[model samples]
Target: MSVSDPLLKSLKRFVLEFRTTNIVVTDDNENLAKLCSVLEEIFQKGIKKSKFFDKSDFFWSWVAKLPSFSKERCNPILSMVIDTVKESKKVTLDLGRGRLFIRSALMKKVLTVPVQIIAKNRQLAREVYYENDSILGNEILAEILQSLLFELTEAHFQLRIHNASFLDRTWNLPIYKQYELVPCDNLGLHVQYINGFLLVKAVEPGSVGEENDKIHAGDVIDELHGEALRGNKMSAVHNILQRYKGLPVHIHVIKGYDSQGNLYKPIHHLIEDADIDIATADELLQVKKSTSNGYKKPPHTILNEEEAEEIPVHGSEGGASHEAHYLGYVSLGIDGRVVRIEDSVQGVLKNHTQRVPVRIELTEKEVLVIDIKDNKTLLQHAYTEISACGRRTDQLQHIAYIAGETSCSLAKKFNCYVFEMKTNEEARFALCAIAQGFERTHLLL
Candidate 1:
């Protein structure tokens, strides 16, 4: 079971980096071998980049050797895998964590789900020991990262995308005026490269009449608000976001295919966000801004569309002392506060404003801090340049600095949690890198 836990985690981690690689888990040895052959045949774009000779090793010892506690601590997922092995000739991997094993014995192929991967950190035991100075040790860390990545999986859910807006009393009729804001989730535009043709990652929550028919994750979206589909997904988004800022817009989509050849179209809705209560939905509708609501007050500062084109570097910071890998989240210190929503579980029940998810970069003791829009100016005097604060030095142990806020100790804001993990110089240095990495890399809203 110990090995099972890490293997699952490792598989999850591997999948994130190599998303298009088709994976098939089987108890049969021959089937596993055939999978490798198929993988080399179809997943060729960068198949050569990821092939590790030992990647397919099914040694039985690896199954019970998780790095966590000596005793078995992984159960839920184990139960599921065991059940899957008990039945079925094959299995289908859901986009999320749970696996569906096909059982033909039942009249209809019964999809047996025995394990579920929730989106939460389940550090089975204490943090694993790692020398900060170690090389970008994927091997030593592969199992750990793999285990962790699987934890980030969750069941599919809906993303109630509505028009995003800002309120302002400065323009139009008193009730009609709004401060123009960039189209966020509400901005009737979205796209993610899956099977290919620059696509939009949008869908109606419930199986609506016909819209549901066209929605699917990998569907190639080839159209943009009447524009002939040209360029990639990000390009289309940049164009639409610039024009639709602070306005109501409609979007149309179709299934798309990648240059390498994979296709998917929606026959059902794929939910992808936190849940909301009916009352919250109703309230949101009442406050929903529309074309008639008047243009919203313009935002004072916004992410420059051009800047996004520059990111997505698959490599790490130039020749750092140690190696780093892309974790797929944008990290930055916007000027904001370290905030915690009070009674968010219940408060968000009717007000989704509280349910919007964001990441808090963690410190040594696990204290989280982030840059929000407001107080970021605090970094102005204390530092020059952007909102984050982490300067690396030769020694692996160093104090990660904070951007802005010259007058206060950014470390103090975390209270007792701040110093909990700074037990030694090495720990402090690791924490510094983590703090800065989180701020500079976390995705900004």
Candidate 2:
């Protein structure tokens, strides 16, 4: 989100060092005033450095219109401005009441510590933050840094990881190509100390180390920028690299661990199955109805001869059909409740050869059904288990008619009218009711 403009960079740098520490854009330009207002807000809010310029896009566009404000002539100044923004405590220039102040008390303290030292520290902090990407830094420490250094979480401090590139026979080492125009500052390499000694834990892909096929996992960082780095912490190595950002530096490494293993791996996650059924609505309603009748009726098996004769072993295959998207199959309990949902419904369906029988029912808001794939003859064999205490057609929220073959092997098509349920609880209750209804309706064959 940086401006990437030279004149603005130079202006900022000049303001940073100006004795009076006040920048007053004398021109009666409204854009200039608007620019100052944004700078004030940025100082107060202290947004992340990467997103700082996002809110000032229009102001930077105005800078582009300034005469003779070419980026090439002021490249070095731009670099300086960028470096200050990254490392310094807050921006050097402070705009307030239509005036800019540069020599803030915080800026004075940082200036006392040589620019290179501050830059090196900031660079190391940035790298460490990226390495421990998921963890958040301490908020109190962040305020103290004033944007110079963000505090690290304790978790990152515990892990020992070394980032080093190695040259070996297993990796076909190639001589690094020379780039005459731009200095080879970013070799895309990082080094570290794992265990007690220096160990190379990571090598970025497509970097100088990886492309040259020189650096590999398990390599020890022997020296950095010509200085021996044995037994040194990764922070020390970061300091060395920081001072030579745009320069080519040689790395000496000793082979250690095998180069065959991957340097880094992705984090894994575990998915859990949904727990569906808990209680049934019919049982609850029966208990309520029994309580209202003055005395609790002893639970007894019903022997309704005429009603029992109507029970069919299996649902008729030839029924009214409807084209509807099949969401997935669900299991219902005795009182009409959803008990379980398949992990990969489509996957199971695709592998299944035969149509899975399901008894459908309706809840207060949604439709509920049971996948009878495991119990092919549930309608016939399980008919005797359930009690026919009571039946309420008004409680039935929906009627899902069999529309097509229930086998999952075929492509998905609308085959049933699924009644809508207001909530998951209603669906679960409805499922249980339908399950009980199925048993009550089936014949004992």
Each model's lDDT comes to 0.26, 0.29
- lDDT tens digits, residues 97-155, model 1? 11111111011211111111111222311122122321111233334443333432321
Shift of residue 236 alpha carbon in model 1, Å: 30
Where is model 2 poorest over a 10-residue stretch in terms of lDDT? Answer: 264-273
Q: Which candidate number maximizes lDDT?
A: 2
| Worst ten in a row by lDDT for model 1 | 163-172
Give the lDDT of residue 237 in candidate 2. Answer: 73
Candidate 1 structure lDDT? 0.26
TM-score of 2: 0.18
The lDDT, on a scale of 0 to 1, for candidate 2 is 0.29
How far off is residue 158 in model 1, in Å?
Answer: 23
Q: Count the backbone clashes (under 3 Å) in each candidate.
A: 44, 30
Write model 2 residue lDDT over 245-333, tens digit each, in one string: 32224465543321222121110000011111211233323433444467532211111111111222223531211112223322332
